[model samples]
Target: MSPSRVTYAPVGFGDYHWTVTDDDGRPWFATVSDLEHKEHCGQGAVAALKGLRQAMDTALTLRERDGLRFVVAPVAAADGGPVLPLDDRYALTVFPHVPGRAGEFGQRLSEAERDQVLDLLAELHGRTPPETTPPAAVEPPGLDGVLAALDESEGPWSGGPFAEPARKLLREHEATLRERLAAFETLVARVRGRGAPLVVTHGEPHPGNLILGDEGHLLVDWDTVGLALPERDLALLSDDPAALTRYTELTGRTPDPDALALYRLRWSLLDVAEFVEWFRGEHQRTEDTESAWKGFTDTLEHLATASG
Candidate 1:
């Protein structure tokens, strides 16, 4: 498909996006993910690319082999793989643009939407995933970065406009951040020690990745798909007691509160860690950077709130 025009889509976080209009006048969504930002398996661009391929391969299998309709997996490239390495820094993938109302990142699903999502998750959790599926992350990919940032000596960061401000914010919440990290470590130990049944999970089942199309709700962004405890997906609905109960009814497994808290805290710290590295690297004050700055500060506030 030859792209006639490519319009920048300033939607979503972490990855860059564009809407491509092919010669046939069809729309395709293009996602460019920074290989460095993802650290689920290990460090470096190579490991990041491997982890991404594992996840995308699992998604493709689920959709094509397992017959999961809700999963909008990536389109395979010329090499018969979904991932195309754009450069050492970024990777590219394309998907058929689902024309519908997409959900917001932090928005809680409504009752009907929640029920549909829970049902979809139940089916997903019960599936026998492909052998290539990697294990779900016990901790955030960027935990080391977060720890390093917290342990750094008091000095101004030198990435770009947001560097110093990010440093100052980190300093202001140093004690709280430390406490939260300690608490997170404890939760991780508890959750792992329990030996809960692991299944294929959408790491971020939050609203932003759901698109309500003509047929029903379709889940996009399968980058986080991996074998993990069900709570990893259910953590999105932790605040909604009714949803939790409903999920229990559907799956006949009681949701673990400690597990829920563990993932919730993990997400906050992940955001903090990602922004720290972003500001510490070669960055400039573009629209994305500015938005990342707000995300950095907001997540810190969220960590404090969780602590309280």
Candidate 2:
């Protein structure tokens, strides 16, 4: 909590935080995620802070290349330019907290809103230097690979002693999920082997990453931006069926069945585990725990049905 730059305090709210000013002064929204950038994880893990700063650089370069001039790092970095600190902490150099009830195009977008998001996402996907391929999937140090390494090794925290119900589902479904993942191993390999058209994508684009700005929208939280199919964003958009329908109308095509399935299973499992973590105080909340539990169970059931 530096006096000069009040981005977020360690003891305060969320992890990936945003400081905004409203009627009662400025407060922040903290998102708990595993993108610890200022500090390294294991030997090769990139820090979240470093990742966001890097993304800021990429985005600004794109904006300028397209002849659009905008501030890069808006708040914690420097003069509104995003930059990494000497200690490895990322900072946004410019911000003016404003007051208002608002929402982002991601949540409930209008036709115009849809256009704005599509444009921004499109810009992100464009302009990667041809040879700049996605970083190779770094297999975890010990296990057979990343997928094989994904586990349900009892999160560090969860609810109290009252027979945490989700645990059973987590166990039962994780086994099922393991099977499902296995079934897709060869297909996943083939898909990657195809050397398909890939681009920088926001691996996750939950509502908080977007903001309503004076010009239109300012997509925030670029931590998870990475190399992936463009449909990754589209798949997330499909999480809102109405949005999906509208988006379909706008784009004049149907969402891919496979991508939807992958996004559903992937997002559902990840969200559910984090919910369990939140139950144990290992994280914070962006959505309800009950909703997560229900969705998680539903997704598992869907997987089971598919497997059957």
Candidate 3:
């Protein structure tokens, strides 16, 4: 099918994405992301796509056993491959449009909804890690590198709409940033030393990744699925005592407090680094300039709070 025949529109503020309807009237969601930008962010497209296919297979297995409520659709090429090469610069993947609303960050979910999400996570973590799934690459935080580049630049920041805000945040919060980096390094060492049990973590299980669909709550965005400490997924729900209780009650796994803290800090640092690169024009332009700038500033504020 020609992609041009489908009506395409932006889905969110990150990456180049579209909601398209095929000629047969089937709805699909398509994402076209720059390979170079993905590599710069520590995700090589080939490995990432492999992990995605592995994740989809695992999720489908769990769904068959009634252990999972979510569906992971891997659109196949004519030859039955999972991913389609859009061009030399970008890759494309299409998913059936889930008829549901995505959970929004900063919005409070009802007690029932929160419990449902916690239950879903419990099921996901309780699954056996697929043998084909590779271990996640652990990279040192990138904030230090971003800081170094900012320090080396001589002129007033003028890269893009996010440039000045990024500069100001980096300069103003230099001490906190340094402290957080050191703390993150220490935590990484401590966690590695203990050799915590590895499980299939969603990497990001926040409400924003949860879809309230007609059938049930569905967890989308398998891009970051990997074998990691269960706390990698639990950290998002750490602040909710009821959710924590539900998870432990359902999965019989206790979340390590230190690991939870470490994952939260790691997430904040990663977001800051990614958005800084966007401000520096390392990524292809897919989202509106103003929206991307606002996201960058918001991420900076989140980093400041996380570090503080």
Give the best candidate by TM-score. 1
Q: Tell me the spans in candidate 3 whose CA falls farther than 4 Å from its real position.
A: 1-5, 39-67, 138-141, 153-155, 240-243, 282-287, 306-308
Candidate 3: pairs in clash: none
- Model 2 poorest 10 in a row by lDDT: 136-145
Q: For model 1, what is the C-alpha lDDT against the true structure?
A: 0.86
1-308 per-residue lDDT for model 3 (tens digits): 55435655645434577877777777788877665455322357665455555665554455555456584555666866555667655667777788888887656777788778777777777788766455665553456667775575445667765666667766776677777778888988888898878888777677777888888788877666778888888787664444578788887776777777788888777776766676665333445656666766676667678666
lDDT of 1 by residue, 1-308 (tens): 89999999989877899999999999999999888767764467899899899989999999999999999998999999999998897999999888999999879677878888888898899899789789887778677887788778387688788888888889899999999999999999999999998899988888998999898888898888888889889888665445577787877888888888888888888888778889888788798888888888889898888788
Provide the lowest-lDDT 10-residue window in model 3. Answer: 34-43
Q: Where does model 1 exceed 4 Å of error? A: 239-242
Pairwise lDDT winner, candidates 1 and 2:
1
What CA root-mean-square deviation does each model show from the true structure?
1.9, 6.7, 3.3
TM-scores of the models, in the order given: 0.92, 0.59, 0.84
Model 3 misses residue 200 by how many Å?
Answer: 0.7
Name the Cα RMSD for model 1.
1.9
Quote the positional error of residue 272 for candidate 2 in Å.
4.6
Report the C-alpha displacement of residue 135, candidate 3, in angstroms. Answer: 2.3
